[model samples]
Target: MKRTLTILSLTTSFALALGACNQESPKQQQEVSAPAQTVEKPESAEVVQDTIKKSIPSEATGRIGDASIKITYHSPGVRERVVWGGLVPYDQVWVTGAHKATTVEFDRDLIIAGKSVGPGKYALFTIPGRDEWTVILNKNWDQHLADEYDQKEDILRTKVKPYSLEHPQERLKYRVEDGGEAEAGIRISWEKIGIRLPVAGK
Candidate 1:
C-alpha cells in the first residue's frame, strides 16, 4: 500500500510539470514572432535651382534747381546677349525695366524734352531705335511690365538720339545730372549705347 501511494504522487507531479511547460510554450512563440516597432525617417529636401535671376533694382535721384527728381528702375545685365535689336526690340514700347514699369517723380512741374510733365509721379517708357528713341511719360505710374501700357494715357512724348559708348556698359543704368541752374540731364546707358534727355522746371 505504501509503494503504490508513492508511485501515484510521482505520476501527478510529472503530469503537472508537463502541463505548465505546454502552457508557457505559446507565450514564448508569440514573443519571438512579433518584433518591436520602429519609427521611419523622412527623406532630405533637394535644392531646385543653382542660380538666381539677373534683374535687380536700381534708383537715380537728383535735383533740378529746387525741384527734386527721382527715377526708379530695374537694371538688367548684358550677359553677352545682344540688347539693342534682340532682347529689347526696336519700335515697340518698352517698360525700361525688367519686372515693373520704370517710375519718374518730380516735386514740381517740369519740362522734359520740350513737353510739360507732372509735379507728381509718372511711368517712364521708351521706344528704342537704332538712331533715335522716343521717351514717353504716362499718367499711370503703377503697372507691370509694358503689357498694361496704353498710348492714350501718355502725357508727354519726346524723341532723343542714341549715342554709341566708347566703353561698354555691362548693366543698365539711369542717372540724373545737375546741369548748372534749372537744367538737368537724364541719361540712360546700357550695353554699348546711351541716350540723354534734358529736363528743366516749367
Candidate 2:
C-alpha cells in the first residue's frame, strides 16, 4: 500500500507541470502577435491678412498749339486726412501722386516757366508749401514714388503759387488747360487747394 501511494503522488505532480507548460501567459501571447502601426496627421495652415495699396490711374490729354500733350498719373484719395503742411509736409520732395511717379509726355519741345524742356516723358515731382510750391520734371520717368528721385536729373524746376479751392476735391486730379494762343496750364487739384504750372510750346 505504501508503494502504490508514492506512484500516484508522483503522477499528480507530473500532470500539473504539463498543464502549466501548455497554457501561455497573457504577456507572452501579445509579444507573439504583430505590432500595430501608428500614423501621424498633418496640421492645418494659418491664414494671414493681405495688405494691398489701392490707387487709380488718371490720364489727361490736350493740345499745346500743334503739339499734342499727355499727362498720366495715379490718383490718391484725401480720406479726410490733412493734405498740405501735414500729411504731405511743408518743404520736401513729393511724388505728386500715389504709387508710381506722375508722368508728363510732350510731343514737341516746350518751355515750362521760362525753362526749356525737350520733347520726352518726364516724372513730375513737387515740394508743397503753404504759399509756394516747386514743381520738377525729372528724366527718370519710371520710378517708385520719390525715393529714387535725384535733383540732378531734373530737366526743369518751376515755382508756382498755391490757390485755395472753393469746393474741396475728394480725389487728386490733373488737368491740361488751354490758357490762350501760346500759353497752356497744367493744373493739379487735391483736397482744398490747387496749383497751376504754365507751359508754352517752342
Candidate 3:
C-alpha cells in the first residue's frame, strides 16, 4: 500500500508541474505579442499619405515668340482667395507660375513697340491692380520666393491694362501672337485677368 501511494504522489506532483508550465507559456506569448502591435500602426498610415501627393500631375506649356516658352502653372486652381489670401497677397511681386520662376526669352534684341529688350531669358513677374496691372522683367531666372524678389534685379517694369475675360480660365496661359509688321503680343491670362505685352522687332 505504501509503494502504491508513493507512485500516486509522484504522478500528482508531475501533473501539477505540467499545469504550471502550460500557464507560463501563454503569459510569455502575451508579452511578445504586445510589442508587435505598437510598432505597425503609424508606419502604415504614413505610406498611405505619401501615395496621395505623388498622384497629382502639375505641368503646362506655351510659346512667347520665335522662342518657345514652357509655362508650368500651379496644378491646383489659382483663386483670388488663395493668391490674394496672404499667400500671393496683394500689391506684391508674384513669380506668375508655380515651380521655377516664370521664364520668358527673346531670340534677339528687338524694339518691343519702341522699348529695347536684349536677347536672353528673363523672369516674368507681376503686380496685380484693381484698375491697372504691372508686368516686370527681372534678370534673375531661377529660384522662387514670395518675399525674396528684388526689384533691383528688375530690368524693366511696364504697365498693362487688365481686361475682364468673357469666360473663366481653368489654368493660366501665355502665348505669342502676330501683331503685324514683325511685332507680337505676349499675352498672359488666367481666371479674371487678361493682359498683353506688345513686342516689336528692332
Shift of residue 121 alpha carbon in model 2, Å:
0.3
The C-alpha TM-scores of every prediction are 0.72, 0.71, 0.60
Best by lDDT: 1
Candidate lDDT values, in order: 0.86, 0.84, 0.67
1 or 2: which has the higher lDDT? 1
Candidate 2, 111-181: lDDT as tens digits? 78888777899999999998899999999999999989999999888899999988998788999887777
What tens-digit string does per-residue lDDT give for candidate 1 at 1-202? 9999999999999999999999999999888765532122233345454133578898999988678988999998887788999999999999987889999998988778887666999999999998899998998889998888999999888899999988988778999988877557799999899998898766
Off by over 4 Å in 3: 1-76, 79-88
The full ranking of all candidates by TM-score, starting with the best, is 1, 2, 3
With candidate 1 superimposed using the best TM-score fit, by how many Å does residue 1's alpha carbon deviate from the native? 99
Which candidate model has the greater lDDT, 1 or 3? 1
Question: How does model 1 fare in lDDT?
Answer: 0.86
Top TM-score prediction, candidate number: 1
Error of 3 at 181 (Å): 3.2
